[model samples]
Target: MIEDQLTEDDVLLPTYGPRPVTFTSGAGSWLTATDGGRYLDFLCGLAVTGLGHAHPVVTQAVADQAARLTHTSNLFGTRPVLELADRLRRTLGWDDGRAFFCNSGAEANEAALKLARRHGKHADPQKVHVVALDKGFHGRLMGALKLTGNPAKHAPFEPLGTWATHVPADDPDAIAAAVDDRTCAVWLEVVQGEGGVRPLSEEVLAAARAACDDHDALLVVDEVQTGVGRLGEWYGWQTTTVEPDVVCLAKGLANGLPIGAIVARGVAAKAFQLGDHATTFGGGPVVCAAANAVLDTIESDGLLAHTRAMGSRLAAGLEALAADSPLVTGQRGRGLLRAMTLSGDFAPAVADAALRHHLVVNAVAPDAVRLAPPLNVTPDEVDEALSRLRAAVADVASPTGASPTGASPTGAAPAETDGR
Candidate 1:
């Protein structure tokens, strides 16, 4: 039912392979397509819409801020930016820290990498090497891409940058083997989002911290996808015992608005001087207003606890489904960011099937389907998604082939308890 006039004429970017459906509007956990079909959005714009689409608080903030002021170059101070930064520092419990703003996760990480290098230069120019986890995704820019460990995404952009090494995630020994006196920084994600929603173990994180300290290297946590209640906390690193010297955040920071930040603490906070880094649209009043509103709403509405409860419910349902299905090899992740790995590479088919069922999910890996639904997703919506996902998994497994475990092609059937 899409209008004939609806075409991709204005889109200039070739980054995404979009689905046929064009979402015209959204509310809470559901999106209304251009064709007027309602679909539950489990992708949540890749975990950017922490409070959901068109959230009243965010909309009001943007509107009001636009009316007052939108942009003021970094030459002038803005109230919204000051307030937002103060709130971030308070929420994250970072003392004697400084924040640099940007327009995307990639930019935030880029700034962090620059700061790390600056810190190293101050210590010793020889300490310039950066160590990151294998399969860890930082971003797509030159510097950020250099920090990313995915070879497939980096090969074409090879000879891009120097002083980067990769170690297997969740392996303390591997990470320890990589960090050395010359290492400038050790960057990692609390939970590897693009690498299949894999969570780094607490031991690994602690060991990385110890290694960085021993080597006088900065520990940078990329919380772009795992921050702002997505992982049941303000930041994913908060869930772990280890603390990072620097943190990069974006995605849910300003709801859907473009905003990224690199926060540095302790001695790392002094890595950059006044003229070292700057951005035109980094802390524009409008975006900062939106971010302040998001933080306020998350607190006032108790979305953090809600995210934890809802995430548990959703994870439990997926786990129960996988318990009987040979198709689902396993499940991992925390809070609303979770993934289910299939026995085979049916992620694309399963995602398509979910779309057919008026649901939206993402295939993060060849055999893994990622779910990052809104933190405010309701119990009834979760129940409906569980049922639809069961059907989709059955449809994919039955027609293709039984799993290697010799279980029925349909795997496990949906529970009859009617939890809703």
Candidate 2:
């Protein structure tokens, strides 16, 4: 579809803000716009297209499954669903655990929250309080939103029922104080993806683990953005010493296809009775088949190691950029999920300038420019992105730049720990 005929305003929900560009097609780390212009995609649809766009393996799997079977009621069992679940279990080392499938990160987290609530009542009826960290993002659904620490996103939809408490990000003392016997679960993101690529400190994660152990609360890790090989490891929790009882995953699970799941272990796995939770399209054959292809391709192509090496190259290049550019604050994040803090409110300007240079990026926060390129992105692509990023930053820092404030660029404060 052309840009004018399919503009979001032409026919769609008004919920989404204005988009800078409309894409006609995508392949690998590049996107083709309707205007016949090509742009390097560093955002990867907010890390959704991990295997890159129009991957042969994933596309073939979807086509093959669609011709055979697409959807079936949960009353029947499907091979693809069973195989995908087993693959996830083995991939994450969640031996013998159960998985609940859904359609999005929000749904996956909602299932997790419900499981935690059910498990909480097993001990104390009043243990429904969930502790989350500041800047940690869960999802848009009511239950999951309550677990998120961003009050602005949840303020408009007031009177949320869940009683969730927020603690300072990476603060051990705050986490220790908030999680206690009254708390039913501690929900956290090992690496805050939406909050601006901030990784939680090991100290705070350890404290949360200890607190959950002491209070008998379920330790839940929201790996929605950090899981499925986004963080070099299969899951971000693997990088940390803490192992969670419940793990949430969604983004990139089926490449571009929508799929979410909650992997629960031990007693937590039994929290939901047969009739308590269900989803019609959660583990549909087509999506599961596509998921299997994604996993297979990741393993066969050695994308994890590629992702690690590419991530290191990106980080080193960004650090070098920081040394030369006064507008750059510092570098933060891991693997392909990374961000650079910009001086002033110049992130949007930098993103705009990047678009002018045929590059796509995301200004997640006022000062944060996030880059979550595909896992299979090559070293050459990483270098090209960095080169474009430098030019974008330079343009934004120019005297007649695109800064909203139009003030001289002042370096961002050295507070690298600001979660998200």
TM-scores of the models, in the given order?
0.93, 0.95
lDDT of 1 at 113: 88
Flag clash pairs in model 2. 195-420, 196-420
Q: Model 2, stretches more than 4 Å misplaced?
A: 1-6, 403-420
Candidate 2, 1-420: lDDT as tens digits: 575467678888877766767799999999999899999999888789999999999999999999999888788998999999999899889786889899999999999998998999888899899999888899888988888889888889989975899999969999899887889899999999888789999999999999999998999999989998888988899978999999999988999899999999988988888788998889999999999999998888898888889999999999999999988977899999999877666676777778888989877777888999999998999999999999989887776655442223553423222122
The candidate scoring highest on TM-score is: 2
Candidate 1: Cα lDDT at 295: 95
TM-score of 2: 0.95
> Residue by residue across 212-319, what tens digits does model 1's lDDT show?
999999999999999988999989999899899999999999989999998889989998987998899999999999999999998998988999998999889998
Q: Please give the lDDT score at residue 323 for candidate 2.
A: 92
